[model samples]
Target: MTQHLANFKARPVACVTGATRGIGRDIALHLAAQGYDIAFGFRDEIHASNLQEELVALGAKVFCQPLNLFDAKSINSFFDSLNTAQFGLDLLVNNAGITKDNLLAMMSQEELEQVIHVNLIAPILCAQAALKIMLPQKQGCIINMSSISATKPNPGQTNYAASKAGIEGFTRALAVEVARKNIRVNCIAPGIIETDMVSDLLKGNEQQAKSKLLSKRLGKPRDISALVAYLASQQAEFISGEVFNVNGGMLLR
Candidate 1:
């Protein structure tokens, strides 16, 4: 029965950062249905425990590790644990990130650094760790969760935009370098998704935001999850170094 839902019975092992909530949680669940054993990183212990329970119910071999992406020591320790476990990681989803919104003029240096460290540097570090294992096997897929804000600037999101834009640059360069090793790198830039993180923004202004979308509605978590699942699958073998926009046609380019 589960085999029908998941096309692959072999079941790839995937690691997803920020899998406790929002888009990351959805991605983890969706991949589990597609027969992936999941190793996830989370900031909050309570949330991580809850997510592990849910994934376990779905019969997924889930590993929920507490990770602070902003801290280099934490990042190194988490990867070291994975290595000691002898888990051959196949798909790496760099979904852990944060936003410190403020106008460029008013944004503090600390705020800027915090956003950059989580959104940009963290992904780079996670990818580097994944590459250490993947390069040897000559196979892997990496999906970095980016934002449409990377291209379409938001008034108070200068720091966020810059960090996301940096992911695009990282994706392209890393894809080229690792193509020979059979490792594929790509990005997903979502716009106005209906997640817990952004529910406040959409609560009373759903109509106004919908007006800006060609689809006439905010994107759902499942919308992005489906794409992530496809990209992680063998169906996307030829695709690499591309930023897929799941934005309800918000940016037409």
Candidate 2:
């Protein structure tokens, strides 16, 4: 039994979307360090290749696929490519997301649709595909990347907030449906993480942003990655349908 347990702990397969950079990239690297083979999907070929190289250097079996979350066909095709004998995934991280920052008054239909499609719908589709594979094994972990904006309304991020809020709701509902199969689903709501996507905002209003946080500092990608690694591990097996806030005390609730 001890030998069997050791074999089980050797390596696990994990798939992370939007892993070319930012929070997703960090999560991918963190998981690899924890003995998980890495498979990530990204829209940019150049960025995806770079990330693949980094993961390979970490001694992980890494596969990077070009996937457009906005395109439903592409999303399905990407997963199909992963449904292979040697690539059975034990963990799925739905981290692919986009933000079209504009007040509701100025938001166009195209803007709202794009955000919803990528942030909410794409994750749902990916989760659905993952569930089919996980059900047979009766074990898997799914982590959805949400945001504090989902709960706290911000002026220019109406579409982003709504999409993230939708993910929160989806996480809770799906967790209940899949718990019987030993599939745990949860979300991580990150607040003001220092990433390339928000470099401009941080650079332009560093002082104002720092003052707003109780921690008096922005969150780092590693901070979020640590929480994600825990939730994906056996250490958090009893945790499900929960939303973790890593926002530097930005939201009390």
Best by TM-score: 1
Q: On a 0 to 100 scale, what is the lDDT of residue 236 in model 2?
A: 96
CA error at residue 15 for candidate 1, angstroms: 0.7
Model 2: residues with Cα > 4 Å off, grouped in runs: 1-10
lDDT of 1 by residue, 1-253 (tens): 0111122225688889988889899999998888888887776777877777777788788665667887888887777776656677889999878888999999999999999999999999999988887888789999998999999977989999999999999999999999999999999999999987798766888898888889998899899889999998889999999999889988963
Question: Worst lDDT window (10 residues) for model 2?
Answer: 1-10
TM-score of each: 0.94, 0.93
How many collisions between residues are there in candidate 2? 0
Q: How well does model 2 score by local distance difference test?
A: 0.84
Compute the lDDT of residue 108 as modeled in candidate 1. 99
TM-score of 1: 0.94
Could you tell me how far off, in angstroms, the CA of residue 132 lies in candidate 1 after the best superposition?
A: 1.1
RMSD of 2: 5.2
Clashing residue pairs, backbone N/CA/C < 3 A, model 2: none
Best-fitting candidate, measured by lDDT? 1
Task: Enumerate residue pairs that collide in model 1.
Answer: none
